[model samples]
Target chain A: MKIRTSEYIITEVFHSLKRNSWMAFASVGTVAVSLFVFGMFLIIVMNMNRMAVSLESQVEISVYLEDRLTDSEIKAIDKKINEMNGVNSVTFTDKIKALDIFKERLGDQKFLLDAIEGENPLPNSFTVKVVNPSLVKTTAIAINDFEGVETVKYGQDVVEHLFDITRLIRLFGIVLMILLAGATLFIISNTIRLTVFARRTEVAIMKYVGATDWFIRWPFMLEGIVLGAMGGTVAFIALRIAYNMIVAKIYDTIAFFPLIPTYPFMTYISIIIVCCGIVIGAVGSVISLKRFLKA
Target chain B: MIEMKDISKVYENGVVALDHINVSIDKGEFVFIVGASGAGKSTFIRLLFREVLPSSGALIVNGQDVVNMEHGDVPYLRRGLGVIFQDFRLLPDKTVFENVAFAMQVIEAPRRRIQHSVNSVLDIVGLREKYSCFPSQLSGGEQQRVAIARAIVNSPALVIADEPTGNLDPDTSWEIMDIFKKINGGGTTIVMATHDKEIVDIMKKRVIAIEDGHIVRDEAQGAYGYEN
Candidate 1:
């Protein structure tokens, strides 16, 4: 209720914080470590998923068409499949050209060459590259039902497993974040509680002397926020260092994989870290002050 | 002015602290609540500030019906009163000036006004030279005086001193009582709780004696009279 009067609470809180800088810093440090691990896990999991999708893109599905189909009908079906969505590119392989490729591959084997010469079983197929490998199964089902299409073939099992793994990773990431956040709040609140306990006498006197609840609660809450933010900053720096180290190792060994953009990832991670710090700190202060501020 | 009508406080275990207390005091009247330990002196003081709600009855301070007052209004009741404890209760981290300024700060006084008022209160308590000293650094007597200064810094209408000199020696007790008398003379009503028979006899103020949760005696000019 007393705006100017609450300044006294702020002044007193800061004075107490200054007196116990080591303790305050230690508490904040604990929060930072917890949040850092959480953020690091999220970033790594996301990158791993991206890497999986990138690897799955290398497999392509090819559907063979009946030789009786006209050139116009073949072009129409290709256009229709492309227009149906998720189809990236469709290239036509002529039956004669496919036979020539097969002959060249089996030219050293006399029996394979003789069998291919006698049967001429190889047919013209459309090599279809989809936008997402995970959609290949549905695309194959649609292609199999289409007129004049012989069969749809791709690494379906590998794609299915990759999708399953990505889903599990996402689910685990969410659960892990919730648990980490809860732990962060617990540790920070306990830390702030110790500080609150030290000044329980001061809080009691202030309350008895007519200090409003919020007036008594604000400075401690702010103290928690400051501690959280400080810890978050430390965590941010550690994460960036860790990110760079890990990214460099991955680039050195697995040069084929796509790495996350450093600048954007850092920016997002920083915001997340700061927000986590503030929330944890605020929650901690509220938890710590609940009992002591009772009327 | 303050009024109390049959205010009673009974603990859950049936140890009655105050029993059907009816009393009233006009503006600027200095009074004392004197009794032995467990005689409800502290309970009576706490009642006026709304620190402990009476079990039953109507209590009014500054025209506000404290019995039916909401929790939000308790601070308003306390604003018009200044309560001091035996323990100084000064923030250990704050300087003497800051400690005294806290009363004004709680009521949201302007910064310039706060500085001026704190300086004046510290001067009244004779601690202007030790404005920056922490409570631990001050003497017991000086600390009590600072506590007194903090209590009256906001110019409250009524001052409650609960054994203000409980921890001081005889000389220091007299010094502290002198400060209270001076404060009362300045038109702030005082209801001090003390069992110091010598101080009570010398001061000759209106004394109300509480014996086992009952007001046994009320005198216009009374002394410490419970006799244990």
Candidate 2:
């Protein structure tokens, strides 16, 4: 690989690209479209995973106490829960604090609770967080058996359904990614094959004139890289713009929606997409050049 | 520069291209391989460059074993030989200079040496002044001359051509042949396959004629014996 040969290969790459400008344009467009779709799905799947994780972390058990429990009895229950495995934290909310929270949540409708205000009907409960969200059910059931505990609730059915949906999303994302990647490779290679086919006689001439396989392949490989890089850049820019608009819109409508932040997350996605584009481009060139290089 | 012993070529569809042939060509000998269509002339030229392997034979071209040579070494073997074809397969977009310089570039020759050798070969082909002219801008004969310049730029010991003048008029054909004679006079062995009887008879070089997969005649200073 002398400097001169490298120069020659670079020149040849640009020369062929210029000669077949239309084909090059078509190739770049196809790569961009394919990679854009890939990047879109990548963003969606990543944000879904993030949301699922955040939701899982929010899962906790609530143990309501039986009426007339003394301070010492509540203390005993708290110490027992502390000794249990997988308990991250236990915060006891007294009925008075619960009532205050309910009043705040009711906002202007606090008048609706005026009838029961003096009785202090809200029960004292411990909000329990576990080290692992998946253990919420088992921990809640165990706490329900305690002498002072009246009931345990942790949105059991809702949590189960959420887990199921998130699992399905992850599985579907993986399958979709694989299919899109395969399709991208196929399309890019076919486009490259047309370019190679057009210049097949040129390749034959090179072979007859003693050009080594690599000598002939270098230009095409470089062409693929160039096209891939261009396409990746295009897709990255498009994804960036589209993601920004969507993020802004979601924040405007649903501020608390757990969408992944746009900065480094998108940066990472762009890098992955561009790198995949490059790899796909190189592989496509190799595949397309295989039959022609037999000379 | 080439030796073939007990060579035979049976295509997969069972067409016998060359059969039980034995021939030896020494260095610097100008020979013409002449035959009718489908008479194995193309296969003979292809075998010299190791483009096609004989079904069973020992082939030595330019001191390299053609049949047993490793795949990686094929390019090295081809490097020592120049090959031309009837279509004058020049890159339509490349200038005459670049087209000739391309051969040297393929072998990764030094930049200065490529520039110098390409100029010299273009000079030999009498296209030095047309160095910047593209293939589409050249006449048939001039395009073939450019092809010759490219083939010889690397100073291959042997030049193999198949129908070098097939696409040109009679005068243009003769013009292409004059370049071949000039090249051959410079001690480069040339093996050309052609159907041009006039040039074959006039050149009076050693001729090998093939018919139906076998060489029917081998003569020095031979005439174009076929009526067609």
Candidate 3:
């Protein structure tokens, strides 16, 4: 009689769940574990991408200047390099300034740099920041052909390898995430199928008594959705705590390393995990019930 | 009212379950369909409910062509009918009250109306005291009664019982027949398929006999008419 929609569905869902409590737990656990792994990979992939982008943007091409160049000629080279298509900025480092940086970098070896300080053989250099990392090699070659430039040294091998590795990591992460989602859907639905199969007679009776397809479907769908959302929520909370602890430990040990901070990123991670959980749960129920719905 | 014209059903495995059958069932009548094992009794009943569509010809139940009915409307068509099985397909997990109440819930009957109708029907079936008892707690006879209660709870114009007393003892079978008599008295058409000769001979209802996918006899107030 005029039953409230949610009340009826929730009662049915709870009844079915109670009848198949063990199977429900298994389904939820499967969804949770799969979702957890998927979520972990997503966060890793996101952070790695951020780190890669930051590193790429900071890639600088260093052009060591000849010691015999006049001041005006060096300035002209600076302007020319700056005017190149993809160069964002050009900063000049004179020989004395370069030696000072060398001394600072050597820390305990400052006395060795002091022996050659007056007769410094270090060359002046122009450090160039490129707008796009993929064009760094071309920009470096163009700058090398400049009249006064002695050598164009840009950690070429290391930078190219870093870009390649980051690209591969991103592609691998996407493929792995898709596979994990497919696997999660399969496991969740199979688990749900066990429960649905057990109660098939009830479903048949409902059909026999004139219950609409949706009327029969609502309870099972609700059960799947509730289980999935719960699994996702549990995984999200666990990830948050684990991520925070790990980040705290890492930051404590390595203060200068860049990481996407816990607070904002976790907020996004929670949304993604919960959404996936609900969608996967609904999809699983639908897939499992396909045979039964024919009647 | 129910009518069938040239209805035929052929299974995928080459078994001809129902072959070119035609029959009509009038309103407010009690008819018994009696047959031997594998005599197409089950297929005939299944055709009425649209559970298995006939391979050919028209089936009109309640003025709608079941053969051409939309898949979505099958459930609605079923709402006008009450069906009971030999095994008393009750939800073992639910109590008697919930079992009967589930029928009304499926049709979206109001809450108070469901409670009222379920209680009244349970009283009719003499299961008022066992409202909270699960199917496992009830005897075979009582479980069949509960199944009857569930079927009739929605007050359909037609009740189709397929061997409603198949699992009950003769004495209990009489008790189930008494309930069917009471329901028929209320002006509801009933088509029952059974092999219970003693009950069929005593009730003196109109009997239609089928053998090997064909109707052999159709008589008024006939006996079971089988020597075996």
Could you give candidate 2's per-residue lDDT for residues B1-228 as a string of tens digits?
Answer: 999999999999999999999999989999999989999999999999988889998999999999998877888999999999999889988899989988888899998999999999988989999999999999989999999999999999999999999999999999889899999999999999999999999999999999999999999889778976
Please list the residue runs of candidate 1 whose C-alpha ends up more than 4 Å from where it truly belongs after superposition: A1-14, A48-62, A93-117, A120-123, A127-147, A150-165, A257-261, B10-15
Instruction: Estimate, for each residue in A120-217, the C-alpha lDDT of model 3 and write its tens digit.
Output: 88999988999888888999998899998889988888898889988998998889899989988998899888888988898899999999888888
Interface RMSD of each: 2.1, 1.0, 1.4
* Poorest lDDT segment (10 consecutive residues) of candidate 3 chain B: B103-112
**How would you order the candidates by TM-score, starting with the best?**
2, 1, 3
Chain A alone, TM-score for each of the models?
0.86, 0.81, 0.79
True contacts kept of each: 0.52, 0.77, 0.82
Candidate 1 docking class: acceptable
DockQ of each: 0.47, 0.67, 0.64
Evaluated on chain B only, what is the TM-score of candidate 1? 0.97
**Per-model lDDT:** 0.85, 0.92, 0.90
- TM-score for candidate 1, please give it: 0.87
Error of 3 at A213 (Å): 1.3
**Per-residue CA lDDT of candidate 1, range A1-295, in tens?**
4566556667756876798788898887888888898789878877877776677787688898887889898988888788867999988898888988877887777466675456677777898888977778888889888998988887778777877887887788788888888888888899899999988987887776677777778888888888888889999999999999988998899986698878898889989998899989988999999998765
Taking all chains together, the TM-score of candidate 2 against the true structure is 0.88
